[model samples]
Target: MIGDIHGCAKALRSMIQELAPTKEDELIFLGDYVDRGPDSRDVVEQLIDLQSVCKVIPLRGNHEWMLQSVVSRGMDDSMWLRSGGRATVTSYGGSVRKIPEEHMAFFESLLACYQTESEIFVHAMYDPSCEVATQDDELTYWTHLPPSLPAPHHSGKRVFVGHTPQPDGEVLRQSHLVCMDTYCFGGGYLSAMDLETETVLQVDRHGHVRRVPVERFAMLLKGCVHWFRSRDS
Candidate 1:
């Protein structure tokens, strides 16, 4: 599974090349695929191409939700642009007048959440009190994980999320929940984790691979808590 891409197409391509995944290796993307970086257009294009050959599970992040609202509900672009939609607009030849039909379809088709017997993948936090089937957009896309969350959700499935950036540029794990968004658009790395093996591979914006002890990822909750507090303060 990979983290929030945020339009870092080069880093995304680099990670995909390094993984060299076959059809049997399902790629679950944790969302925020567009906005904030230079090539939202090309990023989504590559993802669409990858989908034709490999199994890909794409979730809806808050950014995608904003775009979807603007396009489908006739919401204004000001909010989206304020939140980095300008880069996305620029990606499509400096116009927010229209986005390709295919890209709109891609955004519309994204799931709120996906799950297996042992784990759940969401773009953001999930309400532990509700069944995964009953989760809504507020919980699935807009909510960031609080630093106080120290354990897995009540369902016991390992929950994986994105949206919140990790200051240390590492995958943050707390009990059974993990956050993989390392803020690739903010000069951080794009992270991909192999669930079956618990291995993580990261690629920076320049396409350089970065290796860190996988064990350290399991202890990232401390760093995450610190970062969260600092940001909020």
Candidate 2:
């Protein structure tokens, strides 16, 4: 799974090279593919091209939602424009109209969330009390993870999300949830994780790749304790 890519195309390209993903690997992107950095158009173009190589599931982030509202729905553009949309516009040669039809389709087709047997992937928070299928847009694309950890979801599947930028450029991992937005557009790294191995690969705009270890045991034990206590109570 990959974190938010906020238009850092060089970092995205570097991370993709580092992963060397093939047709066998499924790449899930927690979106924010446009805005706030150089090359938003290139980022979207790269993502569109990636679909031909492997299975790519792209979830919609709040930024995408804002852009859609402005472009497709013809709502006010000022809010989005102020919040990184200007960079996206500039990326498309200083006008949203210049955004290609294919790229617009890519944005419009983004999913709210994706679920597998053991994992749930969303662009942002998932309400623990609700089924993943029924999660609202506010939670799925807008809400940031609370400062305090949320309760485990009823489904018990691990949730992977991006949106809450980790300023320190680290993946925030808990037993049930992981946040991979490493704030790449703001002098941080773009993060990607191997779900099966819990291995993280981060790439910076300068094309630097770093491997980070996930502290699995400690988080797992903590979650186990919480689960047991909750069951007992």
Candidate 3:
């Protein structure tokens, strides 16, 4: 599971080179491939290219949902612009002259959820006990939260998630959730978790690779920085 990139295509490409997974390796993208920064469309193109070489299971992120809304309903561009969508628009060469055909399909093919042998991975929250059937509903796929606050997840059937950015990592063991949205787009590092070995390797935009030990996954999840309302705090 990688963090919420928000359209850092350069960072993503660099991380992919650093990780250097072979054709035998399977990669599960936790979604939100577009929005926030530049190169969302490029990221989609890269995702499409990667589809040919490896098993790329891309999950739908909130930003992806927003893009879908824009594509499906011709919704106002303000929602995405509020959250770095402008940068994404610029990444496709700021092309207002003519809408490209390939770009249309790139936005259209975003998936809702990805299921593994024993795990369920998505862009946002995941509840191990919720019987999350892989399907087409955006509500369930893009924004479903657990009924209760998820507990520290270390269950055998893990659920890898993004969207909720944290400085450290956030783990819900009882809920079987592991949050990887480490704010890479907000000057944090891009992250990647090895499913076979349960190891996590991360790199910043500048190309510093840091590997997380298996034991640390549970502990480092505590580094998440969740800031709420000023008055409430």
Tell me each candidate's TM-score.
Answer: 0.88, 0.89, 0.75
Clashes of each: 0, 0, 11
Candidate ranking under lDDT, highest first, comes to: 2, 1, 3
Residue by residue across 1-233, what tens digits does model 1's lDDT show? 99999999999899889998788779999999989988999899999999977899998889999988887898988989999998999998887556889988898899888999999999988777787668777878788878787355788999999998998898897668899999888988899989987788989887788865545665697789889999999
Q: Please give the distance, in angstroms, between residue 9's alpha carbon in candidate 2 and its true position after superposition.
A: 0.4
All candidates in order of TM-score, best leading: 2, 1, 3
| lDDT (0 to 1) per candidate | 0.87, 0.89, 0.66
Candidate 2, residue 151: the lDDT equals 86
Per-residue lDDT of model 2, residues 1-233, tens digit only: 99999999999998888788799889999989988989999999989999988899999889999999999999999999999999999999998888889988998899989999999998889888898778787888888988997888889999899999998998999999999999999999998888888878889877787643435656888899999999999
Pairs clashing in candidate 1?
none
Candidate 3, after superposition: displacement of residue 69 in Å? 1.6
